[model samples]
Target: MWDKERRSVATVFATHGAASGTFASRLPWLSDHLQLSAGKLGIALLMTSIGAITTMPFAGRAVARFGTGTVARTLICVNVAVLVAAAWMPSLLTLAACTIVMGAVAGTSDMAMNAQGILVEKRLGRSIMSGLHGTWSTGVLVAAMAGSLAAHQHIDARVHFAIAAAVLAVAVTWGTRSFRTTAADVGLAAEKKEDVPLFVIPRGVILLIGLVGFCGIYAEVASQDWSSVYMHRVLHGDEAEAAFTTGMFAFTMAAGRLSGDAVVGRLGAATTVRACGVLGALGGILVIAARSPLPAVAGFMLIGIGVSVVVPLAFAAAGHAGPNPTMGVAGVATIAYGAGMAAPGIIGGVADLTSLRVAFCAVAVLAGMVALGGGLLGRNAPAALHGAEPVRVAEAEVLATEG
Candidate 1:
């Protein structure tokens, strides 16, 4: 019984997830096709992060100028093209170039779609962000599975990407029709009056919120990338057991997100986030202290559920924290994405220096930070930002930073 606009925006989220997941699931093939050494491939892959971080600063401006629907729809389609181009690249250099464009388009579209989701949540006057994010996770899972199947069939990566591009392009174009701008969404455009900078570094409350999101994303990224390795290496689990541990984490994460709106509705965002932080911290502790595989598996599952809704709620908070919803979202996204990219390396470095248990202590500390900082998100928000209209950035805040 969802409305057209809400359904359409969800479609946008799903399609974007699918596009990114499709590329991700086929990366092994891509590396082999280009005959890249592991070291060279890592460098090529780093281009995606470089591209995303470099261009994210302008995403808010793009959305303001072009409208959320236009930017989201166009960039998602472009991302598909970039994926196809990447699949067909002749050499490591070409692949790196293609990945950079892939990341830029994908990151901008992500910010734009998030802005649109906030708009939809505003119009609906209830919690939907978590559900939208869950839909995105579902899209990623499904696309990844499909890519695995295609790879199993030995389908050429070139054909695989081209077909995926054609299908995803059509889906995104049709899905974004309702996301187009109208008079109602013009409030986001109103920020132009303040001479807002193209890229406003998050300050004060926004930065605090971003840091809260960072803690959550750090836990999430660390768990997603390292849980299986931890299982096999630290817990001495078999390969199947290690894979199962990863799957368990993914399942709980998706389940938690899908059910998070109801939880937020009942407990309120602030309380839910605080509880999530504590739970995540507890999970991190269990991981650090576990000497057996079962404890570690349970710990990862807890971490999954603990952090599932944190990012969605953070974005929701961001939309209301600043005069420009898009900018607020972009600022938060920039911080959160940086955390995602950094978590793996940081954890690995710590593990190299000491042990995986020691590396996970970092996750525990950050999760504890989330618990302490959780109050900042809700202190200024009214009614937990549920059904609240976007507010003007505080005059003091604007003067302190935007000036």
Candidate 2:
């Protein structure tokens, strides 16, 4: 029932969403094939994070210079191509280089596609942000499952990713047709120099929204990487049993997002996000206290549902937050992605020093902050932001950090 624009943007979201999980899901095979030690493999994997952190901050300018569809489509091709080739990497160093390239492409594509999602959300005039994000979560689950199947069947990683690449190519060709440029994009590229800002530091409520997203981003990525480890090492779960932890989180996260729009309509984004914070906090605490794999899985389910819609809604707010939607989204995405990339290292370091339980407790504190600071998201959100002549940034976030 979605129109062309909405469907096109949704495809972009799906592709972007699948990139991280697909690559990540293949890690075991890749490491074994390359004979990479744990430490070496970790360093190699860092290439993607480095690429993302380095390139994402600059994506706003590219999105402004080119239409979101143009940027997204171009990057999707690059992403798919890189992913396919990266799987064929014969040496450790080469794989690291391949991963770096994939990271750059995926990072830029993430920003562009999210920008497209904002455009579509504006066109719809309702809270469809959660649904769009749900699509991404679904893609992640699908690709992860596919990777697992391929691994189990002992299929070549090259064959698996090449097939994925071919499908994405088809998706890009069909899916990018209706992702047209928005008015905000035109204004950004137009003659009004005063309307454009030199740097996009989200102002007022937007900054708070970004902060809220920061908490979720950190928790989301860290949990994905560490949950299984905690179950295996901390709770003495077997291999298959520990793996179920990730599945539990993924399934519940997807379900939460699929139901998120209705929840947002009923309770509003502000309230929904606030509630997510409380739930995440409780889940983290539960995980810490859980002595068995089953209770730990249950706790992760709560954590998954709690953080599911937080980042999506935050991106929606940022897209419509400032005078320039692209830049606003860029600012928030940059902050959140950076936090997410660092979270694993921080949490792991804490686990090394103390234990996994202690590291998880820290996440609970951040979630509590999200609940405490929930008021900042919509303090001045006007009735409608989709077609507003000149959009305004969140005033509170900007002023609080003012020089």
Candidate 3:
């Protein structure tokens, strides 16, 4: 059982994370191939967000109906196919259409995988979400490294995407096959008795978590979409070297998340997230000010490290937000990812209206929101869910035993 759960956690993260890396690293090239202006590019990107938002409401129900393992395995393959197809899309219209389907396919599968990770975390009775999330960062890191080298070598986008699809497909297939039986597969029979919305706007405590999650997602997606463009266009970086921006960001993000469990254990979620917010802000500022590619790389790395654990913490909170972890996760994902995707549209408009640096200033403000949003978890109710307890409680139990 333990082994199966471990495999579920690892493979589920790999499928989407790797694909995200592939897409992000290749986005500038995709845009160039389509001959898109900044505004047109934003519109294209918005279509993907639209598809994801529409599909997320069904995420909870799918996990309840089909089981997380099956859902994750099936949709992950679909996501890979979309990436492959995207490389060959001939027109802006076709790529926009492809992104919509791609977003929907990837979003639902990611939701299921997250559900699986939560279930496993519950059984282990420790904080594994951060580590599971770290695996996702590792996937992104690997994809970015591969894609960077490919782009630097002037590899055709279609050939590059095809190679990535084949690699991820094999790894995901093998990984999913190793899955252990999970509670998600067992069923949500009793959970059906309660009234739950297919999609919700998150209220009260959960709303705060969702907003912070939004900030995290906003920073991440905005960076993914624009950071490379910023370097290539603004700093006059070599097209090949521009690919390294996403790679650098993903590398630091993976590094931070891989070590996140230890940091969270020591500082707890609230304090840890606050620190990350600070890092994100500083990183954004550095990127805005840096005149050269190397400095921009350093800035991106800082942003990566700072924003690394925000979503993991948000997902951890969402997992315990209500009786049905799936519903809560779905609700928060709706708010965060939905809003996160929307920001880039406005940013694209702004970029067209002014400059990319100005658009990124908007991103820095969102990062500040992450810092301020950390206070919402001040009550630390979620900590109890992860099995944290006071030292005094242990002392009391010991003294009672002595008595």
Give the number of the best model, judged by TM-score.
3
Candidate 2 lDDT over residue span 1-403, tens digit each: 2365677777777777666556655665665678765445555656766777777777777776676778888887888888888778888788878877776777777777787776656545566667878877777667767766776677888898888888877877677787755544322323233444445555566666778888887778767666655776688765445445666776777888988877776766778778988998898889999987888888888888888988777787887775556676778876776556666557656776778899888778877777876665544333332223323434563344232
lDDT of 3 by residue, 24-89 (tens): 787778879988887788877888789889998788878777667678788888888989998888
lDDT sort, best first: 3, 1, 2
Model 1 worst lDDT run, 10 consecutive residues: 182-191
The root-mean-square deviation over C-alpha atoms between each candidate and the true structure, in angstroms, is 6.8, 7.1, 5.2
- Misplaced by over 4 Å in model 2 are 31-42, 88-95, 184-199, 202-204, 228-244, 351-358, 380-403
Q: Local error of candidate 3 at 16, Å?
A: 0.9
Looking at model 3, the pairs that clash are 4-180
Model 1 misplacement above 4 A: 27-42, 89-94, 151-159, 180-183, 186-196, 224-248, 282-300, 344-361, 380-403
Q: How far out, in Å, is residue 179 in model 1?
A: 0.8
Q: Higher TM-score: candidate 1 or 2?
A: 2
Comparison by lDDT, 1 against 3, better one: 3
Tally clashing residue pairs in candidate 1: 0
Per-residue lDDT of 97-201 in model 1, one digit per residue for the tens?
997787678878888999888766654556788888877766665666666677667788789889989998999999888874522452323445235468757
> Which residue ranges in model 3 land beyond 4 Å of their true spot?
178-197, 377-403
For model 2, what is the C-alpha lDDT against the true structure?
Answer: 0.71
